[model samples]
Target: MNWHGLKAIYLHEMDRMRRTLFQSLVSPFISTSLYFVVFGSAIGSRITEIEGISYGSFIVPGMIMLTVLTQSISNASFGIFFPKFTNTVYELLAAPLSTFEIILGFVGAAATKSLIIGTVIILTAGIFVDLHIEHPFIMMFFLVLTCVTFSLFGFLIGIWADNFEKLQVIPILVITPLVFLGGSFYSINMLPEFWQKISLLNPVLYLVSGFRWSFYEIADVSILTSLITILFFLSACVLTIIYAFSKGYKIKN
Candidate 1:
């Protein structure tokens, strides 16, 4: 593998992040903090506890996941899409870097950003409520898994998009809604039995449920199911990426 080339690409992406510190970092940080302020105060006043966990504390994982998911997609999609927009991707395609190196560089940087933001979200949550982790390692696992998987998904979207408008479409129109409806603020069980059954079909529920389980040992679905759901999405993203690169879907042309 071309380690130098990979590092160059990775550092370049990270440098871009450093340059756009507020948009890349501060924007989400403030947005999440506001969610805590609004949801933690307004809603928490009404629903003091959800399944024996403080309403504020219970929503922490979901809120973090919400930001992580959108940020992962936003960072990665823009990372690749800018190159395509500037006609620089042709230069990259002609370079000595392998497809794996290219993916690792972009996806790795995106995941790293998500990790930083996720950690920040956790720290921010502490100010609003007393927080404890029932399973720290499991939380990290779910966190890392979600970051990597979604980054890859975003990388895929970047490749598929031909315009800036297209880039924002899926994240705003599709992903954000899924995260909101995925039992992020409340338990699926709180839904009526009929609606609860329907909620089970939303894939993101497994992610929120699994991450929440690591925090409070309270989950709407089994941990095993959550693990499987994330792994499945990870595999799907990996395979789709492979296909895109092999076919030179948007990179070459």
Candidate 2:
């Protein structure tokens, strides 16, 4: 299917990432590094370990997932949003690329960028703490799955947004807060029993739990549940995108 058109769009998005190296790459890296420094120093001093893993090491998976999720959304959203903002989306729409091919290019490029940033952060984390992967293949699986799922979600955001403010709204107001409360820096087990049950309502918990499980073989929830949760969201995003494309939501208007 329209492989050439797909490659063109993919390369265009990837090239923009190269051009915006600082904002796209360095900014997130520095911000996540700060989380490690602050949390590892101030909080690590008080709490030595969670579930037999060192405080500094324990947060690595969560921190990486946090960065991946935000970066995926931001990268994919901006990748497509800029085309719409510049009135270039119509040109792409008029091209030979089908909806699936267009999505493949944009979302694939965005996921690639997020995966790169996540890998960098993981390497950066290793310098500060001793790290281990109980299951390296599983770790990679969860990493790729998270990037792809959230990239699709971000693509939806791109199509739905009408302005710059709308682009920032969900990530700022909703996602970041969910991550903080979703067992990123601390285990949900530390919470009161009632609150622990309450924490389950936050979807990000499953993400962090599953990713963390790949690392230490310990988790707040079962790996199966986490896998299912991400898969469910991924499928939902896929269906929503197809419907939006068919109905020409935001894109055609």
Candidate 3:
């Protein structure tokens, strides 16, 4: 492995976003604060606590996970898609870097962005509400793992998207809706029996539940189960990306 090449690519992507650091770092916090104001304060006041945690604190994990997931996906997707769109992917293809190196570079950058944004959201949430962290170590573990997993998923999306518009289809059409309906603002128990069962089918629920477990010491779903699901999804995504790279899907053409 060309460690230098991987580091260089990672740094290059980091620098690109760093140049727009104000927007990259601040925009998410601003948007999340708005959610707190609108959803947490306004609507949350009407709704009682979920699992003994105030509605505001209850949604913090989901908000943080939402930012992490979306940022990781966007960063990874754009990192690959922009190169392909501008024909700069040819440069990488000609370079001595292996596919693993490329994935490491892009995915690492994406994960870094997700981590920063997630941290920002957490800190901002602290400003608005008092939150208790039950297991800090577990929270950090899941945060990093989730970022890396979704970043890889985004990298796959980048490879599959032939056009700029197509690149956003999944995040816009699929992910956004799943996040909201995934019980981010409310608990699954609040739903009727049928809808509660249906909500279980949404993978984001596990992510939110696991994250919430770290903070509140309570989870809508089992933390062990969520971790297992995350591992399975992460492994599957990594294998798929590797297969795509080997086949030269979209990247070669």
- Per-residue accuracy of model 2 over 28-50 as CA lDDT, tens digit each: 66876798789997889999999
What ranges in model 2 sit over 4 Å off? Answer: none
lDDT of 3 by residue, 103-203 (tens): 99999999998998999998999999997889999999999999999999999999999898988999999998989988788899989999999999999
TM-score of 2: 0.98
Question: How do all models score by TM-score?
Answer: 0.98, 0.98, 0.98
What's the CA RMSD for each of the models? 1.0, 1.0, 0.8
Question: For model 1, how does the per-residue alpha-carbon lDDT over 3-64 read when each residue is reduced to its tens digit?
Answer: 99899999999998799877766776688789888998898999999999989999999999
Model 1: number of clashes? 0
> Scored by Cα lDDT, where does model 2 land?
0.93
- Alpha-carbon deviation at 96 in model 2, angstroms: 1.0
Tell me, by TM-score, which candidate is best: 3
Candidate 3, number of clashes:
0
Task: Give per-residue lDDT, candidate 2, residue 225.
Answer: 100
Q: What is the lDDT of residue 137 in candidate 1?
A: 99
* Global lDDT of each candidate: 0.92, 0.93, 0.92
